[model samples]
Target: MSKQHEKLRMMLTAALFAAIIGIMAQVTIPLPLVPITGQTLAVGLAATILGSRYGALSAIIYMLLGAVGIPVFSGMSAGMGVIFGPTGGYIVSFIFSAFITGLYIEKTSATVTQAFIANAIGMLINLTFGTVWLKVMADLSWAEAFVGGFTPFIIGGILKAFLAAWIGILARKRLQSARLLPSSTKLSA
Candidate 1:
């Protein structure tokens, strides 16, 4: 493909992943503090497939959409209020999670094992950021934050990480075979 076409394809793919994150954010299981959502899964998948640059681009686009009142956040909430709200840390963490996850896989290989490790780290980052933000924003003690925002999501996070790893690697391999995805080196370039 021409360079222009490749760039356009990557851009469109990032946009599509951004939409996927928005849609996944609606899969919420409510809790006292943070709700469980599929946003992290989508984040993992994007990074595993697109690597650091496009993956982080997808997250940035997703956040920008929500920040501008696009109703793309959890519970369909939008605007800067959601970005600066109690749950905003989780939202903000997606960028780092995606970037780091993709960077890990890029530096290594897009194998299931590497992806799982990367996703697990991403999950930890997400949880840590969210818990601390919840504590500060909600004026809760660390214990309360751990209980309300951290502990409840551990099991679910693990499952999501594994799922993202398995599914992401599988899909990435298929896309590469079909020439729909560029190689990691090409992506970095």
Candidate 2:
């Protein structure tokens, strides 16, 4: 594809991923404070497949949509209130998580294991930021925050990370074969 065409393809890919994230956010398991959601998995996949810049852009788009009162956050909730609420930290951390995951994939040879580790690290980042935010926002003790924000999500986070890595690698290959992926990054199978 020509350079212009490739750029358009990338833009579209990023937007599509952002929309995917929005759609996935609706799939949530209601819990106290931070609900279990598919947002993490979507963020991980977008980052691993789109690379750093596009991945971060995708997450930013998602955040902006939610910020603008779009029903993109969990439980069809949106607006600045949700973001500033106890769970807001996790939403904000999605951008960093995407960038981190994509950076790891692009900087090194993208592999399933590497993708998993990168996403796992991103999850930890989210958890730490979210836990601290929850503590301050809810005026809870460390142990209380841990239980409310971190403990319940640990196993689910690991599973989501693994799924993101496995499916992201597989999807990357398929996209490359279909020439749907931009030819800029080195994501050959």
How many Å off is the CA of 83 in candidate 2?
0.7
Reference-based lDDT, residue 65, model 1: 98
The all-Cα superposition gives candidate 1 an RMSD in Å to the true structure of 1.2
Model 2 Cα lDDT, one tens digit per residue, 37-122: 89999999998888887888899999999999999999999999988888999999999989888888888767899989988988
Query: Which portions of model 2 miss their true places by more than 4 Å?
Result: 183-189
TM-score of 2: 0.94
The estimated TM-scores of all candidates read: 0.96, 0.94
lDDT of 2: 0.87
Off by over 4 Å in 1: none
> What do the candidate models score in CA lDDT, each in turn?
0.90, 0.87
> Best lDDT goes to which candidate?
1
Error of 2 at 160 (Å): 0.6
Model 1's TM-score against the true structure:
0.96
